[model samples]
Target: MTSVGTPPAAPVTAEAPMRRLDRRMIWVDAIQMVISLIPTVVALAVFKVEPRPQVIWPAALVAVLGVVTAVNDLFRWLKTRYRVTPDRVEVRTGLLVRSNLSVPRDRIRSVESTANLKQRLAGLRVVTIGTGRHASAGEATIELNAVRRETAEELRRLLLRGADRPDDATVLAELRWRWLLYNLVNIWAFLTAMFVIWSAYWLLNNFGVELDTWVLGLADWEALGPGVTIAVATAAVGLIGVAGLVIGFVTEFWEFRLTRVRTAAGTALRTTNGLLRTREVNRDDNRLRGVHIGEPLFWRWMGAADTAVISTGLAKAGMGAEPASTILPRGPIAEALRVARLVLGGDDRPFEAPLRPHPRRALRRRVIWALNTTGALTVLLLWLDLTVEALPGGLWLAGPGVAPVAVLAAVVAYRALGHTVHGRYLVTRSGLLTRSTDALDRSAVIGWKFRQSLLQRRLNLVTVIATTAAGYGRYKAPDLDLHDGVEFADRATPDMLTPFITRIPPRR
Candidate 1:
């Protein structure tokens, strides 16, 4: 077993010795494997499957696979070795096909340390070093799994160390118990619960359990009317969703804390959170371009919002994982705005600047689209009634009834469109379901793209997109006057668009 100790402060050289990961990983892997097989064992017992060759062989095969996995993990741990040098961090692994991966220390953008319940109990962490560059597969990042907690911390500081050191860290935000209430209002909670319910039904059916029959048997549909049945089902689903939201919120943000630390390189924002699965992410301040304030319709109604970073190194973090750019989770909108200000160096101008509303033609376009949809639905329903059997007496009303609602939605969507340039940031707000206000650094704008549909061309409107390296690559000001959009983009980045644009007089 490698001795887990505090790493020395000696300057690393090319000749520095490579170190092995903690040997405890082998035991952790073995235990996890055993735990995973418990479901198979339970299923066999529940089904009362005889100890015959057919059932026994498959069970034995599963056991063999688990053992093989454990052995492979053992070999991987024994063969893997890593080292830190003055200019780069390198890792070598594989037995027959040896592979060595190295990332320049200067290119390191963020360092994340994570530990699940099992790894935490084993005093280990998984350290991931990220570089903002886009590369094929695993080329841009390095993962060191099951390293000693102290060793992970040491590597983070060493790889990110700078020439100058500064003062103590400042606490930017901490978890508030009241913030958990916001989780209950999330649409994702119900969606997740429904998905889980469907998965459970599918799994039980696959296991040869008549899940549908059992569900049907639980309720007497004739005794309870359709309205009562729907109410009961809705209540049940709501209860499950609420419970899930509470559990997920507590586990993910139990001890959440965001801090601004003055590192040798510069200031960095660090977030530490989670209960059973703890995570610590350190992001360099220099990489941060701006902030994004998200306000979903439901959240906005409740005066709640979330904040995320418009920064490099986080664009790829959302691939099958929780977003790494989310600095502040769903909370009061005021708190979200406050954190955004702090992240952008206490500049309130980005959020406070009055946004310029788009041309009225934009609203007209939305209304026309909505009316077209209503017409399509109405025609379809009428066709169905004339050719097919007579519809329910009130069913035909649905088509005409949706017109007012759709038109109202169009108006709301139009109200959401706005854009402005504030200080060092170009701010844009759009979307009806989830309004996002992005304040991107003006200097980060690499180029501008003007998109116009056939209809938009007729209306003299265009969607202005500001392309940047940070956060989603581009931010759009949907449905703006064509001339105004070009001028806005030109002013935001100054000389970059000046040569390409012909100066047009402002419309009177």
Candidate 2:
């Protein structure tokens, strides 16, 4: 097969080896087969009165899928080849259409290891090497599945040997049992719970079983008023969400650890977490564009927040939106700030600087947007009330109630609008319920984009977006006075905006 880069050729030197995954992967595949069938078996036993063909067909289909996966894994194991050199690690796989994946030693952003119960029992772990390349989900991850624990450890050492900091690494934060409670307050935990609840209901319904009996538990439908029934159902759904949050957090953050190591290359930020399937990721500090501190309303009330670094080449999947950037999982603002400073190599001015508030027109604009959104909902509700006979009476009232909420949100949004340039950092703070403060490094910004809508032009408002290769690419200071926005952009990156901006002074 071809080398990682399209050079003429490179031999698989014995310094590493051209090897397949551990033979134990066969057993891992077998365990997966059993795991896949568990839900079907439980459903068949729980709902015995359900149609036999309906339940049996699903189980058969699952079996077919399992077999396909098992066959694929087997062939994959047989065909896969991996070799590590001083410069790079490459993996070649496929029976028909071959693919070679490689990560250069310098470009390698993270090397992660994971093992489920089955893999652990089989003395194997999954090793993934990441280059921090901007790719779709799973594209950046190079997996060596079901490898021996010793082999995995050796690979980690080889990949990270010269990457370690010349100075001692700092331990920012260790896993704390008390801090896990913060997970419950996160919006994602509730969203996941809702998805699970929906999926379960859909599956049961498709199988000709009513979930209302299980969830509502034989409530007297006629005796309970509409509001009472709705309240009960909501409570039941919330309980399910709570259960899901507990399970999810316990599994994901079992022994989470975050560290910052000063390496020869730069400051290396490393994170290891997850219980059932443990994961560890390493990223260079220099790649970090800024820090994204998130404080959801509930967590904010509790004086807790989540912090993630804004960095390119980091995968923003599997955990949350920006998993690689996450420094403090869920902790006090003080703790998050401490970690952020460590990641930024002792630069604390960004966090300490006072932010400049946006113009009053910014607030007006926010209120107008809010009114437009709520007004649209009100119209939709009115149309439904008149057109749909089966529509709920409460929904009509709900539309009007949204007006008060929209107004409150607009005020909060106005309060949240602020930005400032602190030395080398261009900090922008926004969001109401999930307040975010992005402290971006000025040097990382490659370009600027100035946008003004018709309404914004009338109000002399402009949004200056700093474009960088890292993090989310475009970090904005939105709803600023036109000149202020342009000045801020020019100040943040000296001489970069001079060519694009032309100022005309007012005549006396």
Candidate 3:
């Protein structure tokens, strides 16, 4: 990729010609219209009768939908025009509203292109140009739904071209089929499968199908017994859940490839993946301030972790919906960390430097909170028993048992809390179930906030949150020793937090 320089605002001249979307967009729209009109076709055939206006209504609706869609798409193609100049990309669209959007070359954070099977065959792709603005479609900016693949690449190259960095491009990581097994550990998939199973049972039953004798009936509870029946049902649900995750990973990361490219401006990170909808995302290296590496309990044991760049334009850390932000999929933890280092301009300085831990009182506070919460639940259960007089025999015991579990989890969390300043990064690690280590850029720290609870104030512990305009805005180093927290903040960004601190002389 070529390094870009700030070019003079060159007007759209004969040499720099404006371009339109692929003319084939009309056919794509027409095909979509026909698919949508399937119900109408079915309705027409089912209610067919000679001289019946009602039967003809479905046909008329289909025709109207198809014609309207085709005409609208054609008009849209004609109205939408984009131009690539030396400094920026300019797009003018809307037949009536007439809105023009411009993205400066310097500010272009990422240019992502995706193409479905049909689009791939036609050499057309949807390109989304991301600036750091996180808003709705109107503000999140440029989106070209149906552009020629070659033209989209040219736009990507032009928009993301930056100043040449010293290092050459390198391949960071490649996709591995075995790593996909780690994707199955995601709990969301199991929950979804269970929900779907229950929903399907309800829907089918409501439509007069006897689920008890059809689907659910397959489990012969009488012959298998309760234990066996439950085990079989659990296995089936687990299989379904695993299947969903397998299908999802297969389609999303089929031929995944990640590369670090050197450009005139800086290092550029690019990823190309997906089987159903092939996608490519190019991100400027400078926008990347930090990295969030996640290690879920199961995946961690499997020696796998996922890493996402804590960049400005991308979605917040831990929001797994945005695949573009993920630098490494389910891979070895070491590999994820290595890739993370590469993205941070080969800064291998350990962000997980020895951290100043919170006081023991912080752990005490957690224990107290957990016990109180469970105690309240126990009281509630007792009150219910007194009022209603009908309750499960061991249900009340569960309320008290929860206290120990909560305290154990809290103990683990207390141990996990740690923060440190490493080089130019403000690193923090926390969480019990799913541990997260974030190494945010000190330079990216826009503001600081000090928070204290009633108990925290008495214990001289405070939660200091470093605020930034990028990725999850606020990251907290919670329950820190008051003096140490302030000192750490001041050191992280000199003079920023010092004004708030005042020294008190020793009393005689």
Tens digits of per-residue lDDT, candidate 2, 363-429, equal 9998888888888888888889888989876576776688888888999888888999997799998
Question: Candidate 1, clashing residue pairs?
Answer: none
Q: What would the per-residue lDDT of candidate 3 be over residues 338-361, giving only the tens digit for each residue? A: 777777764545454686677898
lDDT of 1 by residue, 1-508 (tens): 1222323343676588999989998999889878766655776687764445644555577689879978887888989999987777889998889999886666777777888888999999998888766543446577888799999878877876742243477888999999988888656667768977876774554345766788789989779999999998888788788888899889989899998888766788888898887877778888899999988875677888878898875636545445778898789998988888888985456987899999999999999999999999988887787777756645557898999999999998999999999999999999988889999999999888988898888898889999998878899999999899998998899989877786533323
- Tell how far residue 173 is off in model 1, in angstroms: 0.9
Ranking under TM-score, best-scoring first?
A: 1, 2, 3
Runs in model 3 lying further than 4 Å from the true structure: 1-18, 32-79, 93-99, 136-138, 162-168, 191-222, 316-320, 346-348, 380-397, 503-508
Error of 2 at 21 (Å): 1.4
Worst 10 residues of 2 by lDDT: 1-10
Candidate with better lDDT, 1 vs 3: 1
Residue 232 alpha-carbon offset, candidate 3, angstroms: 2.1
List lDDT for all candidates, in order: 0.82, 0.78, 0.75
